[model samples]
Target: MRSLVLCLLTVVAFGSCLKLPSSFKKCDRKRTDFNQCLSDAIYGALKILDKPLPSHGLPSLYDIEFPDEVATIGNRTYGLLQTYYRPRCIGLSKPENINAKLEFGPLTSTLTIEATYSQLTVETGFEAQGTIVLLPVNVVTPFEYTLVNPTYTFTFELEEYEKGTTYFRVIDSKLDMQAHGLKLDYKQLFSNKILNDEFNSAMNVKWREIFALSKSIDEDVFAPLFGTIVNGFLKRVPVADLFDG
Candidate 1:
């Protein structure tokens, strides 16, 4: 979920270079409709990123493969211990109602973006050995999670980096997300069929509780990962060239 969302931000932050594909539209800072233009440009850019653009340092968003991610539900005192290995995510809906704002300052700048995505689906191998809701269970099974109508807000703080030419690098970043619905499916909870079915049923019924419990993962895992990847590409092109004067 983190990598998928930030990939869009990477495209939005990329500067205007000569090698860019014609699909990307640049907005002028002096224009009154700059925000609307920025939103339109970002929507168009994401649509054409179905294939990797090596010249632009962009990867295919058709399927985003992520490294093993480990996260715990609660502290050692108490909570469920959950882990996900080799998660593959797809079905990233095109962003809608996109709004992008860039506040240029003398020393630094801030970029705040708000967008809504229709859906995102994730499938991963899961392991849960610890206690969940006072249930003693150890399970290793394939997990599928889906988010419906998720809206995300991202704010990036940028500073100038000089590499012969002045470029922008993300110094800090924050991400906030809310979803209308969530679907969770993992069949094998225990060796017993009855227990397995009941557990899976409970999870599907109570996914909102799970989401609230794991909400911190956004800040803990997503934000830093997003900042690093955005900065990696954002620093390549001169800041002055990203927008029209």
Candidate 2:
């Protein structure tokens, strides 16, 4: 670990003897200059993140349509539900409190990163028109909702191996849901207004559950996406290319 950290600081050939300019515009993947190139890229990315976000910021839109769905929460079961979600906006602020450590070895490389998000928002239209059997009364309704104030400590480990050609892989990932001041405004289309208000109030009371659900969803969705994106980018591109190019 110590050697890995040291390797990031100085290129082997230039150690204690060379000082490059603060800004290095180009990174050619040369074994002799690998470390410096990696350093320049990493710090440069951080510097870019530190800059103010554009007025539009980053927004992601997703449309989820389910013809039939089934969910068994504890003992209750919701079956044969037609659900749809059109996420109008899913946005996040630039990462804050970025902390990263890298380990480069003879055959493999690993990077662990930790960061926080100051704000995140999601505006969506959701409707699940279905029947939830509850022994005495069967509830059927179309639900719609929105959320905000998403904050969390995101951490992950990325590993790369050089058996034949270096490639990236997501070894592990976790989300620490520090604070999610989630405010949910939801309604059941067929249900009475008073009943919807009561249900929404009850839902708001389960903030912890919301955090837990978000974490689970993040793992299922984002984790695999990261693996795909990273590995795809590094698939044929050798780790050496980052430094040698």
Candidate 3:
């Protein structure tokens, strides 16, 4: 009877010693274990950025917008341009990926991806209304721009923070994407191919400015849309599901 009491006391004492601190207790698993699992899950999730993209057709993300802007028209000169683009439907498909890499870095719980997409197909119908100045004249323009096959490359960064019990919110995220061979078929408000050609030639002279705008669109527009998709998926799956049993 005495030996039985002693054994019971020992078991109780050992269990008590295993008790975690208050902060750690709040989580579904030990902090280290949870972090490891989350890292692996994050790596897997980032790779989906390269996967076959489905048509995203609802919510505001499906509708892409480009606002009024001004850019250099040519060397040593600036052009004033105003643009409004509203997409009725937009979707991405055909992921031909050359390579992709995902890294879960320790600092700030950051997830970084450096990926290259060989080709992609973008389907869209958007009202594009814009007027751009070359030097002495404003070129009036309005069109329905639709596209087919496009190619892309991207660099991405996202930060993760715990929302509650095994769920996380990714914030302050940014994504940069570049497009190539994207042909926009235009159904214009007015037919003036020669004037449009002149505008295009002027824009080509200031290619650097257009390039900067592309990066801005990626950061200011596409980043949040991508976060919604990624973080929404993360919230659905439990932290336990991230681990290898």
Candidate 4:
């Protein structure tokens, strides 16, 4: 009887050792596949601006859409669906929670991005050149003219990578007028008004230079502009190890 009791006790101990507690058997949350998560996060960050691209010459606030398949990173693919808008003289406010998805094999990751804007406002005040006097006795002359307000929208996208570093390219961009309502003389009380075309031309040239500078990948050319926009996005998202083979 003593020997049988000892054998039964040994069998019970062996069974207990083989059976792990429920908590010990649970999978660790931190051990998630980083490669996959990185891809999802990057795609999620861009989905914030996924709206229809406004047609050229349309003088209103409109959505700027992304392609159905914006990009492919490793074995994953990303796409953007929709965006929101608020028009202003300086810039348009992007919508909240722009929707997007990442697909890797059978896995799908969803994400949201809060879009915002940095504005560059160009304002020109000119004096009207040609004027006419309503009455010879009336010494005052009237000037008739209009004011032009133009706005440009800048968009961004990631392009290439090497090692742990990634490079971005201006994927799709636009230059359009945000507001074009005419500004006219309220009262025909003044005559010596003159319009300055030179100033307007100079302003346009400045804007072109700024846009060109934004596109240049050279550190000297684009660093300042990149810091303003792309850097923020990069900081918010997780980048995958570009060297992963």
| TM-score against truth, every candidate | 0.81, 0.51, 0.48, 0.23
Error of 4 at 170 (Å): 1.9
Could you give candidate 1's per-residue lDDT for residues 60-145 as a string of tens digits?
Answer: 55566667565555442366667777766574326656788888899899988787878877777878776766777577888788
When summed lDDT is taken over every stretch of 10 residues in candidate 4, the lowest stretch is 69-78
Query: What is candidate 1's TM-score against the reference?
Result: 0.81
> Which one wins by TM-score: 1 or 4?
1
Clashing pairs in 1: none
lDDT-based ranking, best first? Answer: 1, 2, 3, 4
lDDT of each: 0.71, 0.45, 0.41, 0.29
Candidate 3 at 221: error in angstroms? Answer: 1.2
lDDT per residue as tens, model 2, 1-245:
98766655543532321222244234654356544555456445444433332221211212222223222232224443433343332333244445544566554555544444455444434544344444233344444433344444334455766544444555665554455555555555435789668767877789678766755653444444434434444443444544443
The clash count for each model shown is 0, 6, 0, 11
Give one digit per residue, the lDDT tens place, for model 3 in 50-168.
Answer: 33333321123223342322222232234433333432323332233333333455543454544334433232233322324333433333433222233333344544444332433
Model 3, global lDDT: 0.41
Model 1 misplaced stretches (Cα beyond 4 Å)? 1-19, 74-80, 131-136, 191-194
Q: What digit string (tens of lDDT, one per residue) describes model 4 on residues 63-135?
A: 3221221111121112221111121122223222222222222222222222233322312221222222322
Candidate order by TM-score, decreasing, is 1, 2, 3, 4
